[model samples]
Target: MFAFASLLALAASAAALQVTQPSNSSGWTTSGPNTVTWSSVSTDNSNFSIVLNNQNTYPQYNEVLEALIQTSEGSVAVNPPSGGWVAGTGYRVNFVKNSQDLSSLLAQSDDFTIEQSSSSTFSAVPLLRPARPRPLVPCQSPQPAPPPLRRLARESASNTDSSAGSSASSASGSSSSTNAAPGLNVQTGVYGLLALLGIALA
Candidate 1:
C-alpha cells in the first residue's frame, strides 16, 4: 500500500510539471496561418516552440515558422535558422524547455502533406468579432429645396415686362400731347399779320 501511494504521488508530481495550454479566459487569441499561441500561461518563464520533421520533404516549413511567429507573441527566441521546410513534412511543438540542444523535445510522427501552406493559427480562445459600424446622421437639417429657381426666374421676368410696359405707355402719352399742340412759330406769325392789317386800315 505504501509503495502504491508513493507511485501515485510521484505521478501526480510529474503531471504538475507538465506545461498546459493557456485558457480561453485570457485575452490572447490565435491569428494568421499555421500558427497558434498558448494563452493564460506566463509568458515570462514559459517558452513556446515548434519543431519540423522531414523538412527537406516539405517546402513550406520555413513559411510555417514565419507565419507562426507572425501570429504569436512571447517567442523569446527561435532556432534552426529560419526559412526551411518542404511538403509532406511532419512537425511538433514543445511548450517547455528541456536542454540547450532541444533533442528531447516532442516531434510529430505523422507527415503533413502541404496543401497551399496553412497560414492560420490554432487558438484556444474565441475570436473577437468586429463591432458593427454606426449609421451616419446628417450634421445639419437639410435645407429645404431652394425656392424653385425656375419660378423665381419667371417672376423676375414678369416684373421686368410690367415695368417696361409702364415706361412705354408714359412715353407714348407724352409724344401724343406734343403732336396735338400747334407750333408756337405759326401762332406768332398769324398774330403779327392781323396787327399789321389793323394798323393799315386805321
Candidate 2:
C-alpha cells in the first residue's frame, strides 16, 4: 500500500509537469518571434528543455530547434534561424522537464503552421478569403433613351420656312415701292396719245 501511494504521487508530479500554451492548430510566423508556453512546473528546483519539432521531417523525424533552458513558470519564445521554418511547414513546441530518467515527455503542443505571410488565412497556405460585396444596380428603372429629337427638329424647320416666306414677301413689297411698274408707265403714255389725237382732230 505504501509503494502504491508513492507511485501515485510520483505520477501526479509527473503529470503536473505540463505545457499550457501553444494550443492545437496554432500558427506562427516563420521569421517572427514565437512563444512556447507551459504550466504546473516547479521553478524552484527543476529545469526545462524546449524543443521545436518538424512534423515534415527529413528522414524519419526531425528536431528543428532545441534548447536546455532553465525551468520557469511562463513561456519561451524563439525567432527561427534563417530558413529554419518555411511556408507550409508543420511544427510543434515541446516542453520537456529536466529529469533524471529523461524518458518522460512532460508536455508537447499540438501541430501548427509556420507561415510566410501573416494574412494568408493565418495559416501557411491560404484557404479562405473574405467575400466581396456585389455591385448594386440603380434603384430607378433604367430610363429609355431620350426619344429622338426629330420632332423638335421638324418644328424648328417649319418655323424657319414660315419666317423665310414672310421675309421674301416683305422684300418683294419693298422692291415694288422703290420703282413704278414698267407696264403702268407704258399704259399711261398710250392713253395720253389717244386723247391728244382726238383733241387735234376736233
Candidate 3:
C-alpha cells in the first residue's frame, strides 16, 4: 500500500514539470524572438534542451532549438532557423533532459501555431494623390464694341445724301459746281444770250 502511495506521489511530481508559457492559446511567428517557458519539481541546476516539433505531419518533424539550456530559469527566447519555421498549427515545444544517448523527456508545451511573419504578410498601400485640378478653359479675346446710336444714324444719313447727289449730277448733262447756288447756272445763260442780242443790234 505504501509503494502504491509512493508511485502516486511520483506521478504527481512528474506532472508538475510542464511548459507554462506558449500554452494552447499562444501564437508565434516564424521570424520570432518568441519565448518558451516551463516549470520543474527538480531543484537541481542541470541544463536541458528545447526542441520544436510539427505534430501535424505523419512522421512528425523535430528541430532542436537549443542544444543545451537551463530550463529552470523558467523561460528562454528562441528563433526559427535561417529560413524560419513553416507556418502552421499543431506545433509544440519540448524540453528534454540533456543526455548522450537521447531518451529523457522533461516537459512539453501544448499545441500552438507558428504563423508566417507579420512583415512578410504585410502589403504596402498606395498613397492617395490629390485629384488634378480640372484644366482651366482658355480665355477668349473680347469683341470690339458697336459704334454709338447717334454716330451710326449720322453716317447713314450722310451716305444717302452723297448717293442722291451723284445720281442727280449724272442725269443733268451740264457740268456745274454742286456746292454753288441753285439759280447761278440759269442766270449765267440769260446774261450771255442778252449780250449776243445787243452785239447783233449794233
Candidate 4:
C-alpha cells in the first residue's frame, strides 16, 4: 500500500516539471522570428533559458537557435540563424532551469516541424503598382451638317430652265427668217400676184 502511494506522488511531481510552451507536436514558420510560449512555474528562481534544436538527424541534436535568456515572459522569442530552419525538419525546445547548484532540467516539448508558406518568403518585399492612364480630350467644336434641298426649290429650278429653253428656240427661228435674201422674198410675192390674176381671167 505504501509503494502505490509513493508511485502516485512521484508521477505528480514529474508532471509539474513539464514545460507547456511549443505544446506537443506544434509547427513554426521560418519566415521570421518565432514567439514560443510555455507555461511558467512560480518558483523562487527567476533565471531560465530556452533553446530550439533540430532533432532530425540520428544520434545527434543540432542547435538551430542560440539559447535565449527568457524575459519576464513565460515565453521566449527566438530567431534562427540567417539561413533559417530546414523545411519538413523536426525540432525540439527545452526550457532549462538556471541555478548555481544542480539545476533541474525542465520539461521538453514534443517534436515540432519547420515549414514555409509560398507567401512567407516574399512577405517583406514591396508590391508593384499599376500606372495611371492619360485622360482623353473631346472635340471642342463639332461641324454642323448642311441643310437638305426642299421639294419646292427643285420644282422652281426645273420650271425656270424650261421657260429659258422655249424662249431661246423661238428667238432662233425668228432670227433665221429675218436673215433671208431680199431677192428671194420679192420673187415669192410676184409669183403669188400672177396666180391671183390668172384665176380672175378664167
Could you list the CA RMSD of all candidates, in the order they appear? 14.0, 13.8, 15.0, 17.2
| TM-score (all chains, Cα) for each model | 0.29, 0.43, 0.50, 0.46
Q: Write the per-residue lDDT of candidate 1 for residues 39-112, one digit (tens) a residue.
A: 33222333323543345533533222322222125332332234333233243334323333445442222333
Query: Which regions of candidate 3 fall more than 4 Å away from where they truly are?
Result: 2-11, 99-103, 120-202
**lDDT value, residue 68 of candidate 2:** 63
Q: On residues 1-202, what C-alpha lDDT tens digit does candidate 3 reach at each position?
A: 9999999989887767678878778778766477887776665336788877776898877778787786457778886665567888888887777644334777778888877775753346899999989988999999999999999999999999999999988867454545365678789999999999999999
Candidates arranged by TM-score, highest first:
3, 4, 2, 1
Residue 198 lDDT (model 1)? 100
Clashing residue pairs in candidate 3 are none
Q: Residue 65, candidate 2: how far off, in angstroms?
A: 3.3
* Count of residue pairs whose backbone atoms collide, per candidate: 16, 0, 0, 2
- TM-score, model 4 to reference: 0.46
How much lDDT does candidate 3 score?
0.77
Q: What lDDT does the true structure give each of the candidates?
A: 0.45, 0.66, 0.77, 0.65
- For candidate 2, the lDDT comes to 0.66
RMSD of 4: 17.2
